[model samples]
Target: MNAKTRRLVAASLVAVTATAVLAGCGSADRGGSGAQGGVLKLWTHNAGNAAEYDVVEKVVNDFNASQTTYKVEIEAFPQGAYNDAVVASSSSKKLPCILDVDGPNVPNWAWGGYLAPLELKGGEVPLDDQLPSTVGKYRDEVYAFGFYDVALTMFARKSVLDEHGIRVPTPDRPWTRAEFSAALADLKAGGKFEYPLEMGTGGSGEWWPYAYSPQLQSFGGDLVDRSSYKTAEGALNGPTARDWAKWFRSLVTDGYMAQKSGSSPNDDFLNGKSAIEWDGSWDAAKNVEKLGDDLLILPPVDFGQGPKIGGASWQWAMSSNCAQPEGARAFLEFTRKTAYFLEFAKATGTIPATDAAAAKIPGYEPGGRYEPLVRAARDFAVVRPVTPAYPYIASVFEKTAKDIVAGADPDAALDEAVKQIDANLKLNDFYAD
Candidate 1:
């Protein structure tokens, strides 16, 4: 809650309750500490991530050198502390003109008046070429856009799968619910590894929902019903959701995985301690580098519903109270260049935001080794529930899922999750504010 994570339970409460304390959102002359009118300040949460920080620095340097109307100064903070800093700045009315936000938090920030809807003129950004999940939209209004997105997939060794007689899965024909279970069973029975799967069950905060909820969605359930965004109700406790929870728990009960995996699931997979490791694309390159052609980056499983991977990452947006709103928009527009996207994708080893940019990246180009990942991102990605209350809901779902996986009754766990979510929605007046 003290940190700036969108799935932070405490931060979610702050996001909803602290709106009154936030300075009013409008075109005000109260700007940042940068030089007067001609200077616009930009903030980033990449202080610890050298690769992404360098990419942000390169973009700002080029943008500043390319223009005279606005000089965008940078203030980079460590990711762990960045979100909290934004919240504190917003309350004191000292937010920078431009800032990057976690995609899931855009609705909360926008609805709370901390962010303004983006106003990119026609063709300013290649919105069409960008992956749908990279654009952060809330209530039908564009709020933020990222230069890249990360996809989730399973990492396996071809040798292990072949030894276990597990069929390799593709995006078009992913492992069904039964097939995936059988594969895990085969791996477990082979006795080559203590556990057949490693899914980073040790992860916390946002990772829980970002990694697990998509499986729930694939089972024809979600953290909440997107149609209303008001409550969990049938979405969390319904029959499909119950089935998903049972399967989720069965992974541990059936000896397919650890209730809490090792701190480094990727390393476990790389060491052959686990036959399959369900993880995000951010870890794919290192695994690929180590295993080379033996590494298998497989798509998510199809659980009655189509296969899915959670989408959306960090994205840029203008603060609602920016003083030089026009300058802010100008810098925002400048960031749309495909070249920046290419640089970002290269710098971070991530999937490019646009296909044009992806074509420029070495491994992500057409028919390249990483090409299936890009296709998987396009075909299977699903953004989390788009609502101001999403942060709260995500937190609740994380706890509920953990409880169920630890052997709590699925029905009781889901019912508790639904009750908590509905109570929060009612407390916030359904986030109508």
Candidate 2:
């Protein structure tokens, strides 16, 4: 089944299960005395990620030890289930004092009255020093900030590219649309691998928008127009968007990539089953382990608007219902230290949030092995739209894109997507105040 069907099924299951689970939870009393020498509850979507959880625990421990006024108590949830849990919590008015939010969800949560504005004092972490994509802003106010962000790029082995006579692309001089297409065609003509590229079509959920929307943007199309933050109309279904759709579907039709690639594209690339893999920085360590000096981390193709990649990862935020905003803000400020950012990036193998933090990380600094990722995040990253309707917009795009790939007419699919997105925006009154 396609991703849209899977998502619908998952949503049905979550809806059926959430009611029973949330029934016993107590409502969050927003009127209580603010963290009066008491524990401030925190939530994280790192239940199974030991390395990341370990760093989080260390930060919490340090924060508690350094303060006598309030202590932090944390609850961990698996990433897949965390959003459902948060939604249930919000419905029951039982959100924690502080929580880690996925970047795109910030606007949704904040708009739903679940997240409060994160007020960081001046000189906290030099927000300007961080990549633009790492800061989550809604309605012109900062709602969340992440410790690290990931960049998307094409992964290949130098030997394979050299053997195929394909020109390696760099951040400064990435392959244009025609050049990229020709390269892929040449690589496929060799017929050594099943396909020349693995676009990670097998992955679902946010991966669809995170990986593919940038390509759309590069084609002068967008999920929605940022000018008004109100509609997907011409931006999504325009002539340029149709061009992006046709080119995207052609990747499969021309046999340059699989309609449904292997379960693990990175592994396929490492195992020599594919020549190039479009993926994120999270796979860098494992790819390096397998390919060693043969690894070639190439930039995303410049479709038209000069190469673009989706940005923003997990970010920390304060709950709007938290009575202890001061305590929550204190923890946020405490964790903003460059040292902690370095630690998190090291533990998570993600690009650090700030230049200072990046400088501290070994492979992310200037001339380091993974500096290409840093440059990509710095030069090409574009955060998903900051509107509250992003969730609906993303779903619409995913379904439309999947249909377009599955032989549905691009114009019709995009028109339907734009209609749905516009309807959603209207239902929420454009999420106006």
The number of residue pairs in model 2 that clash at the backbone is 0
Clashing pairs in 2: none
Listed per candidate, the RMSD to the true structure in angstroms reads 4.4, 4.7
Model 2, range 251-301, lDDT digits (tens) per residue? Answer: 989988888877778888888888889999999989998889999999999
1-433, model 1: which lDDT tens digit per residue?
2223322333444343433423422222245733376888788888888988998988889889997878888877767766766776665467788899998888888776678888787444567779999999988899999999999998889988887788999888999998998998888888787788998999998999999999999999999988888889999899999999999999999988899987778888888898888898888889989999999989999999999999999999988778778888888888898888988898888999899889888888998888878988899999988888877887888899889988999999999999999998887667774
Candidates in order, TM-scores: namely: 0.93, 0.93
For model 1, the superposed segments whose C-alpha errors exceed 4 Å read 1-30, 33-35, 122-124
Question: The CA-based lDDT of model 2 is what?
Answer: 0.83
